[model samples]
Target: MTFVKNVPTQPQILAWLNHVKLFEGLTQDALMPIIENANYMDLKQGDMISYEGMPLSSCFLVLSGQVEVYRNTYLGEEKIFGIFSCYDLVAIAAVFMPHNRFPMTIRAKIDCSVLFLEKNSLLLVCKNNPIIMQRLLISFSAKLYELINNIDWLTSSSAEQRLGAYFLSLSSKQGSQFILPISRGQLATKLGMRYETLSRLISSWRKQKIIAIEGNKVMILNVTYLDELTLPSQRAF
Candidate 1:
């Protein structure tokens, strides 16, 4: 995979995350309620943090490095849901879901540092920090919006439109040139198709001059076309 711009050290990255959107304008004492009960854990590469069946409590904030959320698809093949990086909140659904079990497994793509807060501790944090809590509600709502947007993207006019929508998501995160975080197989899983199908689609895309893939770096040659695909019809008569 094409590498992300090297982020700072773990502690520095942690500090950065602590100052992010949800935590912004919030003093350490304001977060002290949750931070006090939170434990900072280091993970070795390829280590699995939470498995599918086990119950989960505390949510993880990826303070440093990248992580993969994946599980076995209905087809019995490993499927990647997404890649999470610094400042990304993990295990959110389990914290609020009915069963309280992680729907997917979390694996470290590289050495990682995550802040874990216990259930009671998180509740206390919310109880104490109303301002930060408001911001969190906004953040959670934004996640729901993102999922809804994904649904819209899936209902593309054509196969190329679907592929274009996918690259747009990556570019939004990684800048103009998107570096895919997973292999061809895992990407196929994310796209809900076989590897060969995705390969053929990419081949056709290259032929159509929509995108150019050299290794993991996917250069968007025509954003106009991709954007047009993503933006639905305006109900013009």
Candidate 2:
């Protein structure tokens, strides 16, 4: 992990902040304070961005690459909640929640650039601008909906069904040929399956020509066939 103390120019910071959902409609004047006070950090893959139950000193915004938010079960299995990419903010809910502690373990999914904003400075800005508060609420609401969607994968009857749903969701968000954001091991945990189970399902899909996989890159060969596997009746959660 690299601590980048040199701050970006106001114009550069303005461009970056404008892309974030939480600051979508914020004016240049409204965003000045945040940009001026923000600390930039470039994290290497596997670096811990935040730990579960740690005091909320600051919140992060992903400028590039990805971050993984996850938690561990009593048996020490990691349960990946989500992979956050560019223009995404991490731990927005923690900043405003009654309990001021991180809810999940956050790590750099890949080498990433992130902006760190101290909690006190953020709160001061929000107090002066109700719009910022409203934007944050909207962001937190979207996160809640995402968590609801994840429930379906947890209750899938077969690994194939889980993989199909995951692929469909990705295809919907990105194009049909986008690369996997997280590693296969993390993907298995997100789908509540063993790594071997995920690999076997992918292999079976390949045999049927449903998908073509090259390293971490996956291309859906038959979207219709994948759709059939994720019928509403077949979904458990």
Could you tell me every candidate's TM-score relative to the true structure? 0.81, 0.84
Query: For residues 1-237, what per-residue lDDT tens digits would candidate 2 score against the true structure?
Result: 788777687888878888876677778788766777888899999999889999998888899999999998877877888788898888877888788999999999889999887787778779889988887777778767766665754574577777888888888887888688777987887777889999988898899999999998889999999888788624343
Clashing pairs in 2: none
lDDT of 2 at 132: 84
- TM-score for candidate 2, please give it: 0.84
- The residue-by-residue lDDT of candidate 1 on 46-110, one tens digit each, is 98888887887787788788889889977787888877888787876577678878888888988
Q: Highest TM-score: which candidate?
A: 2
Model 2 ranges off by over 4 Å? 233-237
> Which pairs, if any, clash in model 1?
none
Error of 2 at 206 (Å): 2.0
Judge candidate 2 at residue 9 and give its lDDT.
77
Model 1 residue-pair collision total: 0
Worst 10 residues of 1 by lDDT: 1-10
Q: Point out the worst 10-residue segment of candidate 2 by lDDT.
A: 228-237
